[model samples]
Target: MSETRTGIETNPFDRDHYDYSSWFFWVEASEEQKAEQLAQQEQFLRVRPDSSIGERCFISPLAAIQVETLTLGRSSYISGHAYLTGTLLTGPNCTINPFCVIRGNIRLGHSVRIGAHTSMLAFNHTITDPDLPVFKQPTSQRGITIGDDVWIGSHVMVLDGITIGDRAVVGAGSIVTKDVPAGAIVAGNPATVRKWRVPELAPPTAASVPSSGPVPSGGPVSSGGPVPSGDPALAEQLRAFDQMVREQAEEVLARSWDAATGRYVDAPGHAPSVRAHCDAIEVAAYLTGDVPSQLSREEHVAWLRGLQDPASGMIAELDASGHPGPRVTDLSVDDAHYHVLCVGYALEVLGSSLPHPIHAVDELGADGVIALLDSLPWRGSPWRSSNVADMLGTAVLWNTRAGTPHSAATAAGLFGWLHTHVDPRTGMWGADDPRSGRLETVNGFYRTARGSFAQFGLPLPHPERVVDTVLAHAQDARYFAADRQNACNVLDVAHPLWLAGRMSDYRQQEIRQVAARLLADALSHWRPGEGFAFAADSGTGRDPLAETPGLRGTEMWLAIVWYLADLLGVSRSLSYRPAGVHRPEPAGSLTSQ
Candidate 1:
């Protein structure tokens, strides 16, 4: 008999219909025939009554799960027609639906649900070679790790090596490529955080949720909507300071960004700094209105596009006009990582505007950015605190927006490793140098690390200790190398001050006073007509420093102080008071290349 005569005619060649459940649709059968089918399914089952499954756990007769490598807690069930392989573990009350292909090393916390048609694989292929077929490529066997109470929706693809945190929901059809922070509600092709799941005990407020504005740009200031924190006085200050900063930033843009050449100028006698160009474009796009008339968005997009190596998402370290250059060999893993972030930020700022569609800045989108991040060199050790912090922070931000599943466990693991190196008294992790033992004194890096942890929703083991160290340092006259304002001290001072305002309730008042004093000390160096000087004593505090009419670094500092003040003063939602949004701190100048 023809298959169509026996059942609904379905193409056997369809990959989508190949799961174990396809048996049912392949033939239409009467009730008596269905009973025989069920019996046959049960007879073919590999699971024994003595298997690891607990009492009251239901495995549908039609399901085909490999019993030997699987372990299920009490009351957990696998829906019918699912094909599962590899070492799988699930806690109590878990529900895995049919047509799911879950394989390799996988773990699910209690009350987890693996929706129908969801596919999660634990390994990936390396296709870097041009000559070889992809299947012939080397494979990487990194597993998937999921936390308790997670809800994965149907049609979701949880890629290899990704981690989904507890209480997190993977929206239907999201492609998770990186680690997801706990309690995040993410949805998209490359998942981005739609909102955070607040604890039941917490008061209802718009904390951590994006403000309804022209578009969601991550910063203290809301360009179109109501100011996030409703403080009229601070709002006034922010407006005045934001205007000043915009003007100075515009000046930098005019001088640095050459529309014709698509290159940012550098200090005399060297290549135009690729890093500087990207940083300026990102900050400019962020600070300026969605469609600023000063420069064409298309031009900026074209410039960024020129830098990309299409085959690989790697951005060149030098522009066409740049000389004495950073050839491909000179491009370090660190440079690539930072530039990728810069590009992502620019795209975010560009795409997030009202009425204006998310224009693709270059061939590279969020996925391209993820590719760059994934390509970073893995250094195993008591890992470098800075690298770990940077990677984790960047991953969190990217995953929150892109919906890519990076590993949350991987980030948490790195954080745990970082915790081991922390100075208990200072609450600061040490420098990257392995030899720097317990006695090594804290430096500016401590402040940056603290900020990264706070921004990324990671706890600073002992924040008060770090705050205390910062406060003590600011009180000393030697905080600035020679009482002259420099970028280093400005940032070192700004990070803690900003954190205190943004993170601490009781210490806000104290931190504000210190910040005011520091701001005053730095401002005194401003030579009205000449703008802020690099150094007043004519000493080079940072290498190759020079006096200039305008410096991007200095402008960044003044703008940050004003922005932080506004942020601290705003009457924030109760949600933000506990831990502020994951938005990048403006004074995170240390993050600059």
Candidate 2:
């Protein structure tokens, strides 16, 4: 076996070995230093009842293993050429192999084994300028704390400011850039959780159909097959309508694109919105096919690169010139949700080639986005409006689409969080914070929430109860204004219809009928030159509705059209964002295919 002079060696029959003599030089310790190390060891052993310093523990006579500020536990052994600084505390039976570099404050619990050639850096550089050298950049320090029974394998790089929890196993050659939970098995370039050392649960099985209860009456119950299109003429008409909407959507989206910056403008000469830009990409892709005009596609990519915020791992709004604008900090839940939605959509649309501002999402990919979400200040609330559900669901949907490992596991975690905050009586989200007032579910919350859940068909806790309450509200005359007029902003009607049709499995017949009625009413307004009118008055569908003229409500109106088409059985085109976006089937029958 090849061995260094300090007695650290490669395993028997392993010919490969690293020469540590040059960098791992042993400076001869003075008699005083030797006395100090021995004295400290003796004192530690005396004070710690369970501690033991094993016989013939290798402490090189010439090696610079600083004895001060380090507390050794029972039978703990550190091989030579391991440079350690600051205050380090090790538990009993800890084994630190050779060529391990540690700095700043560190705490290792019982039986922790740090493998060979590992580096645990507690201070990391902050690289703000690409032009400047990393060495010249400012540094931030956060100590490392490894819990008991943790095993970090060979050639691992643990970056600054993270904790490795108890019983965790960090795989060989991993780069640990984030905190790890207890009993996690992590690996990769920027280490992600491969699996949790958790108790296995029973696999999910198909839910049993209710044995004796009849489905609520209004519309027909699901046939457990494709929704049949009885009227082929209506199907053709709907297809033509969808095509027209796509064309109009394209024209509107084209105006939103800022070629120089690649960002989608909120309005003329206004700052670019993260949500709008991502949404525009999907619109462009769906309308023009996946391969948008090469120039437009390139510009879209540039917008993604320019809008990303490195510091917070968020994609922020940007000025017309491409400079980062207002952040999500202290923003409303709707605004903040939009920012997160933008990131998820980008990953879904751009896939692996998405740019990295600080290499946050790009470095660790989906895990990076998860980490960014974790850092945000948003909290669980049952009454906090449906945007919360949309945000959570979007993250889950996009992450799943990105082909990230353990996406289901991550999504389950978010769903659990959502479940805990739901109001038991109302079957909707309620405020979790005691000081916060009850916020009503309005302002497009129901549609957004319903659309989000419908996208992935993920299981939600107590789903039946929630569906019952929502249905009751939909049937109440007071809920839709005194006259219960379905005609309003086009989305008000189209949105609920899409939500109703897509979620038919869980919804009541009354809701579906209402949605169908609203959709028909909205469609009646579609005009040859003016397009779908924004509203319908007493028995008359008004084209170029007098309220809010000049393309007002046009953007959301197109979104509504897309959602309705999705319910009508259209293949989802890549030109739209996920979660809130739906796929249509069964044409006018409004059923999934």
Candidate 3:
């Protein structure tokens, strides 16, 4: 059977056939035959009372499923005369293809694709008594677990007590005996890692415009289509969502906006923060059009101008907004980069431009640029390094758009430095911090990639590797829980998937599924009148980070909703698109090499 196999004769995914109350062709069976099949199924259930079958699961009548305990998950099925015995546990979206033999205790995670004629045995016959017949020896249950998003090709035989790691690929006709590491591509008998499906850094794109010339006027902006859903209420729901968001925004402005300071605080009680004001632009732009981004541009611009220092043209981190960035400057590195995003982009959306060149003309020489890149705390804090990248990318881009002095040359050097330093293994910045694992690094990848690569329409250095890594991070059970998943984490994951999806088609269908699920889950974060919470149900700072419902959460999550919906081809239902930082646009000025 093909990896793309839906069903042999019928679409096994048909909801009508998902029910196993009467057995195969149960719908067509006579009343008497249906009753008989029901009794047989009842007897099977009674014998194995530990079975926990999820919704929309299909267990073919032809398949020989004799098990002590079974935990088949939703949207998963057993087909093709499969020989399944003993205890079996599988997460959602798994498939045990036709003619497969799964024996003993087995555990499979979400989206585990077991191809046709594959066999996975989890127990071994005790060989202590060599004199005794092999059949007479007692069996030991050593469970076999195939991790999430794994692909076991046709005719593969996973040996007893084997554990295949997440996002791994087992070639067709291969035998897996040893433990396969995560992100490995293994083949041959007694499978060994042939080549790792690890991260490969994306290459830097060339800046085509002249060094001192002005960037072309119309740089492409990323957006999604009007792909509408069949659901009739979808349009109304989107309109309602918009209205609610508008209501929330209006209420936030009324309550959270500091009339005296001309800045918007996240919430009523919190002190005015730079982040709140920055997020305001997104929320306002999201509601209105992206061209004239904010509600009141003149006031916001005046306020933003006050924050900039006269001598250095730098903006300092005002208050705790729970954002991370390069901590290089008092307006030098960290704040400068962050302002480039908040202040710089906010101005663009407001139908204006940055008041001054971010870094002075010729201030960032080749050596200075390299120093800035190197100075970022890549090892201890990658998130900060990525912030710096965002700042540099934005600075170069903004300059290029204005045709500022040495802007094109600056982009060239910056791209060159990035090309030199990107991690080959992870396709992100720096090595994975053993402290936080891929959580921090993957999140950091978004900040840098979004600004440098996606913002400029440049292909990622290692789009495939980046996609795999980002998708892998989502597998962590605790990190992605709907109740606990935060706005920052989901945005980090989503933007990367959306951006990388534009560059590569590797496992894209799976990516679409993941996005759709995540979009559904993220809906829970909505707070009705208050708008979206940074973290679900964490109204007043869930952990060290205050993720309760606020403007920041609304801005980030609304952006996420657009991205996920767009990826799933249902953005048209939303009736709006992101014109904010989260947008995925191709490079207009820079030519792809």
Q: Encode model 1's per-residue lDDT on 221-329: one tens digit a residue.
A: 1211222444456446446544565455555555555554545643223346655565455444334322233455545544554554443344546656652234232
lDDT (C-alpha, whole model) for all candidates: 0.48, 0.47, 0.64
lDDT of residue 60 for candidate 2: 32
Candidate 3 displacement at residue 123 in angstroms: 68
Cα-based lDDT at residue 14, candidate 3: 48
Candidate closest to the true structure, highest lDDT? 3
Maximum-TM-score candidate: 3
Best-to-worst ranking by TM-score: 3, 1, 2
- Tell me the spans in candidate 3 whose CA falls farther than 4 Å from its real position: 1-240, 260-262, 289-295, 317-333, 360-362, 538-541, 586-593
> Model 2 — which ten-residue stretch has the worst lDDT?
584-593
Query: Could you tell which candidate, 1 or 3, scores higher by TM-score?
Result: 3
Model 2 alpha-carbon miss at residue 520, Å? 2.6
Of the pair 1 and 2, which is ahead by lDDT? Answer: 1
- For all the candidates, what are their Cα RMSDs to the real structure? 17.8, 18.8, 24.6
